[model samples]
Target chain A: MNTTVHEYRTGWKRALIETKISLTTPGDLMGFVMPTAIAIVVLLFMQGAEFEGAPVSLGAMNMPSLIGMNIVFGGITAMVGALAMDRTTGTLLRAKSMPGGMTGYLVGHLVSTAMFIAVTVIALLAVGLPLFDGLEFGTPDRWLMFLAVLVTGIVAALPIGAVLGALLDNPRNMGLVVFPIMGLVAVSGIFYPITALPGWLQAVGQVFPVYWMGLGMRHALLPDAAAAVEVGGSWRTATMFAVLALWAVASMALAPRLLRRMSRRESGSAVAARRADMQRDW
Target chain B: MGHPRPHDGPAIAVADLRMRYGDKDVLTGLDLEIEPGGVTALLGPNGAGKTTTIEILEGFRGRSGGRVSVLGVDPAHGDERWRARLGVVLQEWRDNGKWKVRDIVAHFAEYYKPYTDPWNADDLLDLVGLTAQGGQRVRTLSGGQRRRLDVALGIIGRPALLFLDEPTTGFDPHARREFHELIHRLTDLDGTTILLTTHDLDEAEKLAERILILAGGRIIADGSPDQLARAASTTAEVKWIQDGRLQIHATEDATDFVRKLLATDDGAVTDLEVHRASLEDAYLELVAQFEAGEAAAAVDTFQEATR
Candidate 1:
């Protein structure tokens, strides 16, 4: 009988429905699995290489790092793309017309995106475990750390994505966010150790969620001795979680304001204008 | 529900509604009122701000200045409970492409559960004529079928007031006819107050019980379809053959003219036809009259004539 209880329960159902949709729909399924497949291909090429005095092959080191990259892409870039697509398709305006529909919609996306990232990261780990010899994910404590890192990574990434998604009305402008993330991954040492990058680039990398999550994942799965090749020559575990938690807090505080502003401006004419611009631009 | 039924005043009341876009003024001192039931078609030329007016009422857009009340709540301040009482279907929508038709309907119906009992999803789909296409994905439906789905989603919450912006755009004759019947069924089921905007006068005449023709950002004619037709143009055109030649004449009194023609030249008149101006003609005349710098006089005259 309570309104908030009913709305949130419906939101939970929506998330389940959307998760099924993403799993079955070809375009959506491809968006989720394509990055993992590419990571496998890239790791295949790195199988023979090893970092100096590191405990595992370069491929094993890069495996969990790539999982971090998935969290960023699935949580940030993909979320932004979904928001932009929904705007052009009038889905957002449709939600605006319904009572408590916006609340349901936001909760649904958050839950569904988290599930997709979970599925993607698990798939990558399953595929990587047999291929890499030194992955330390078998221990119970390692699993706990994996769950912790993934949760904090999503918390850090999704809100920033929502904030950016609210700001970019045009889907064409999505490239503005995607390319920068791609550039950040390069400097963030997803495919290489942060110690190999220039000190300034490593410094730039350490400030963002992507590099911190990669470090957290490495701390979770890679043999602890592999920390010799990391920036601090030991897993700076506290700093990793603290940095991600800080990003999550900052983004969480700012996202709702931006999202409300964005939803307030959503009307039929606004959707029509965006569609018209898309057709013209395309 | 915090919002009890409020029917004493007009369902929608707008006074001095004004909208401006940068340098252009779309609506200037526009005022309107609609009672609780029946369909009212808002007719206006493009850029006359029919969409703007409807959006303002739907609480999707904020007005520059006006006193607007929809369902006894100012739309600018209309809350979630206020939104729960209204339904809106815009001209075009391509949403939820991956969701099945019936699934989407049943899914959206859940959002209204906090405020009101929603329509049964199966019955709603049948009413909107999407029963056969229930299992089909939304993106696969034809244009008419898609619009019917749009209507189904709009009213799933059993809204007391519904706003349809050009409900039937780009519909073939057959589809348009079916859509009109569905609209009739909706209004008859509950006295759901509906305000629709459309460019098709025939559709307006057929679906709406009352028609308000807006020109120059104001309602120039407001009455039933027949009244506006009669108010704007009373002169009927008469065509007849006399002495084996065709003759055409316009007269304010067609019955008298025809009687005189038959009395004076009964043998010579072989073919005769009388044509009264239709709603389309009256609509064009009113817009033209308003554009030629004599709108106030023309509208006043039509108001007097209609009265």
Candidate 2:
């Protein structure tokens, strides 16, 4: 096999091993489970309430939005967190030492991140489907649309995560990303409809992937009449796909260049310096 | 598993190498050459630019100005094929903490498969004396064990040239000894040139065939262990008891002095002892002089004395 091809094959193996480790390790497993459990609890509480002027329960309305929000969280935060931690710990330098090792390291993370997002989405839906009513999972079209939204959502968010991961020097500064993401979540209407928010806030939310991703999920799982609460009283499936595809294209263009620059700056001294900083902080 | 190189020049050659970290010169016109198949130690005090020099040669860092060739390729533009022929053991590695020793080794070994046959993970583990700990998490390993694992990864590709940066900084005596033995084993392999940096003079004496003492941005001393000791103008101290009186004398020739004293004493000399200057003593003096801002005088003095 060609060298790059072989490296990518090894990357897939790395992904498999990492996924197995994450699934088997208690702490890692809990990271996936805890959020799902909390979301399910929230859904149960909202099951009794109904959205104003909408036919579905509030729980049904929030379920798909939560799934969309989880996709963005899993794709973006997981990528950024993994890259920053690996760079801090000298894993990036280790990869730089070997032939074609950087390729393997990156491909491995992409695979693992995709798997993580998929597993989280599946787990959330599996637990939420039986406990909630008015969820539109009974038909093949719903499942297919759900799969499309899931894949497209990850593709849109992951490269941006990679760019953020590459730009940040200190893992401790990861909190810098969290606040903005939470703000985006609040404006993007993960818990409620953006239609009820200020017009400018709705416009601002529309400009980001988080809102569009939530909109895509809502289109897939919510009943057709539920579109009454969305902008223009329509699903706007074409607009959602176009905006997400644009984000994916723009991020994919920028991520590799930024990632390459970051990898070039990796060395043993850089790692040692970061380690020293971490020690001082602690 | 050795791959024939396209060229047969020295394993490493550097000339007029310079490294400046924002106007402060860490290495000023540093030069070195290493032949194949033996261990060479770059001995220096901390902040002597040892790590900078090694990292430049490893292609991990770009230099300010220099000419450096490792395995007949300039590291700045070295391709993956060029990289596959070299092994680098970093000073400290805290990566893959969640990985098992065997698994991590196996994963690294896979990267070398396209270039050459790599050491079997199990065999490499045994070679590094980590066979019993292969199943354990890497973060749980002791410091010494982790260093040994680092060595295992460095040699997994059967690299023609290996670079170790301070291989045993925090090792206890027994672990240091074992690490030294492992290095010796690596040198026994066919045509593997090893360059290691350390601040420990005793380690340099024990493991290296040639020693280069780097100080103040240059190599102040270069020779074998005994030659380095002799190159420094450090005399041995001779102690003896003659006619119920203690006598102590410092002399350049302890053997001749002891012989003459014994001949004159006529069985009266007692409690005679000779203490020659060890390599550690020579290193401490050279570093002290360099740090005291007499770097040029220290180098000239050593070179003059040795010549």
- Using DockQ, give the best candidate's number: 1
Q: Look at candidate 1 and tell me the lDDT of residue A183.
A: 94
Per-residue lDDT tens digits of candidate 2, residues A149-240?
99999998899899889988789999988779989999998898999899999999999999988899989888899999889998899999
For residues B1-307, write the lDDT of model 1, one tens digit per residue: 4433555789999999999899778788888999999999998655568899999999999999979999899999988888998999999999889999988999999988878889899999999989999999999999899999999998888888999999887889889888999899988876689999986678888989899877666776788887777765577899988877889999888999989888988488977999887667656655566567665665564454444
For candidate 2, write residues B1-307 as lDDT tens digits: 3354555889999998999998788999998999877999999878789999999999989999879999999999999888888898999998888899999999999988888889999999988899999999999999999999989988888888999999998888988888989988887788788999999888898999999988778777788887877756457799989889999999888888888888877799899988876666666766677778787676665555444
Which window of ten consecutive residues has the lowest lDDT sum in model 2 chain A? A16-25
Task: For candidate 1, write residues A1-282 as lDDT tens digits.
Answer: 688877788888888989999888999888767767887888978888988998799998999998888897779986798789999999999988999888888888888898888887888889888988788987899999999999999988899899989999989999999999999999998998988988899899989899988989989999999999998798898989899999999999999999999999999999999889889978
Q: Candidate 2 falls in which docking quality class?
A: medium
Candidate 2 residue pairs that clash: none
What DockQ score does model 1 reach against the true complex?
0.74
